[model samples]
Target: MHTKDDWITTPVTADLLRGALDVERTEHGVLPHRLPARARAQCSDGQLAMAEAQPSGVRLVFRTRATVVELDALPTKRVYVGAPPRPDGVYDLLVDGRPAGRGSVPGGNTLTIDMTTGSFETRPGPPGTLRFDGLPVGTKDVEIWLPHNETTELVALRTDAPVEPAPDPGRRVWLHHGSSISHGSDAESPTTTWPALAASLGGVELINLGLGGSALLDPFTARALRDTPADLISLKIGINLVNADLMRMRAFTPAVHGFLDTIREGHPATPLLVVSPILCPIHEDTPGPSAPDFSGLGEGRLRFRAMGDPAERASGKLTLNAIREELARIVAQRAADDPNIHYADGRDLYGAADFAELPLPDQLHPDAAAHRRIGERFAELAFGAGGVFADSAPPA
Candidate 1:
């Protein structure tokens, strides 16, 4: 085994990365992207662009005999106007497939966003280092999971031993798409996100496409999913659509169909699970265009509320209830010929009772505790015995 005295610096390369659909060599370093260049080119929406750039499920995987490792990264952390400052992004390290340590860089850039004014400002900051030491002897596979909500630039990697690309674990890959709730929301760290937790429990590799504020059933996103290689797949829909108020029932139904159809074209026999929105009481019966409530911002607290009238539902505006029904119907009707397709109501994971105990802190995203509960429940319902995803292998 290499000793601490023999530390060596290695350049970050694509071969040692996973979960990112694409990677770009930036002037400062390599920037991992959740969406491919082609897909990114198709949309100029700032939200989608920023969301995809966040490395929610992206990780650096390698094998080495090093007992110490360090990664230098430049992370751009977001700060909402009239909201409390966010904690530094965390980097979780796993040794031989188990949690070994967690660390965060001290400095990076800052993005201040004013929701009410639709304005943002970027400020520069310094790069910081994340270190993990006292690894066990002999060669071992190491994974450094990037922060789910941070846009990180890979600056450099240093270790006590020479590193090589990690051998594949031979586990099935599960690709998931959703909103901020699935995008790490209030999760403590990248690996603790519900999708990440469920992936660990299900014994499957995860490719998270949970773009915050951007899961609007965009065609480019569907195409990205269609082209990615995956043995199991799922989509958590509804929340973002309602909050964005980007469409009515007329456009939503067709958009959902188109998204599913595009995915099926590439994954004809893959087990595809359709998940509706979790129980968001504020939007259960009411329509949205959710608005920020900064009443407590002076005290460093932030919250949200549905702005649309409940009566608007009568005019074909979408609501949580409407989405759930449509998703169920679509899956049932399609299952007649495509038995591989399945539906799991999001409420099954976080229902009314669960909310009574652990409410969403922001009235939108789940809190850290709620994230854990949802992750565990998802693993049990979708990946447990007789569940829709029980058998991740493609249909025979």
Candidate 2:
């Protein structure tokens, strides 16, 4: 029941906001995963704190314009929401009181809504906020009906002013794709999701295609990216493949190529970055159930089993290391001709060193501090020094 003039602001404080990395014990003493020094300065201690800090549950937030004023041109609208494990739900979007799009937020970390179907033809100021930007655009009135026990908070709403019409013109867009890890799992806020963070840091318009539990290199996903508009593009793969044991080396290599090939059909020269997964122990050198034993689930206290038998490790199955090696080979071969294409191992953003210092709270997904670490690293590497997007970026 808030309005446009309310101006939601995340408070800041000097006290330390407990981070996800702070929840567990590690081999190298208690790891210290902290927010980027800059983030600490912006968010109040209370704002930095998580509402449901448990490791096994999912938390999401859905938001969009409450009213739209000017509608000279179709503005790019976005809705930001946080994530948790096993997030499954349906989000319906509407515009001008008509159904425009429909989508699902399967369980994972991050969820985003982008509204970009038809041109804007309404008046300005803020006409009842166009509904649901996190789902595919074309939706009219935004309404999200989620399953019970799933927690969500409407965080923020954003849109770009209509651009002046031009005869010979096109918009610069960024198309990014990745797995649940990229989807912002366990991150504290909508703006903190690594892709969102990177987009904010990079100062580029983005279509976040990060699907939780759905980055399995599906042909549908590749086609989605292929048809989407983008000036720059990136695809983060590997982690999900390893954890799910979806494909072997032979199938993986070809799948990666095919996925890229599909995208290339649409954005032939756009800068494309292929990112591998970040550090994850359960799938680092090991296959996964990635499952947790929540035998002791109390009212709000959920605990999980962290360690598994060594025999499981020796099974010679898919692991993060294995995925990284395969990705390297793929990029090495592809980069020769596609100079615009690039590769980034997930670890470079948050690898063994970071994990050694701050093991993931549940040994799978990163905590808030880890998210900050990943964000800072991504800002440095992906956006380059002195990037402006994440610096002055608004809340998601």
* CA lDDT, every model vs. true structure: 0.92, 0.50
Best by lDDT: 1
Error of 1 at 377 (Å): 0.9
Q: What is the lDDT of residue 223 in candidate 1?
A: 94
Q: Could you tell me the TM-score of candidate 1?
A: 0.97
For candidate 2, the per-residue lDDT at 184 reads 67
Give the poorly placed runs of model 2, Cα more than 4 Å off. Answer: 1-172, 299-316, 385-396
Task: Predict model 1's lDDT versus the native.
Answer: 0.92
Backbone clash count, each prediction separately: 0, 49
What lDDT score goes with residue 231 in model 1?
90
Instruction: Report the lDDT tens digits of candidate 2 across residue range 1-396.
Output: 335455333211111111111222322112121222232344343212221122111112123333332111111122222212333333333343234454443223332321123122322222122233343333122322211112222222333221111121133455667765665666654445666566556665445555555567877567667766666777889776765566666677788999999989987876777888887766666665354434332222233332334355355455677778878888889878876777788888888789988777666677778878887777677667532122322222
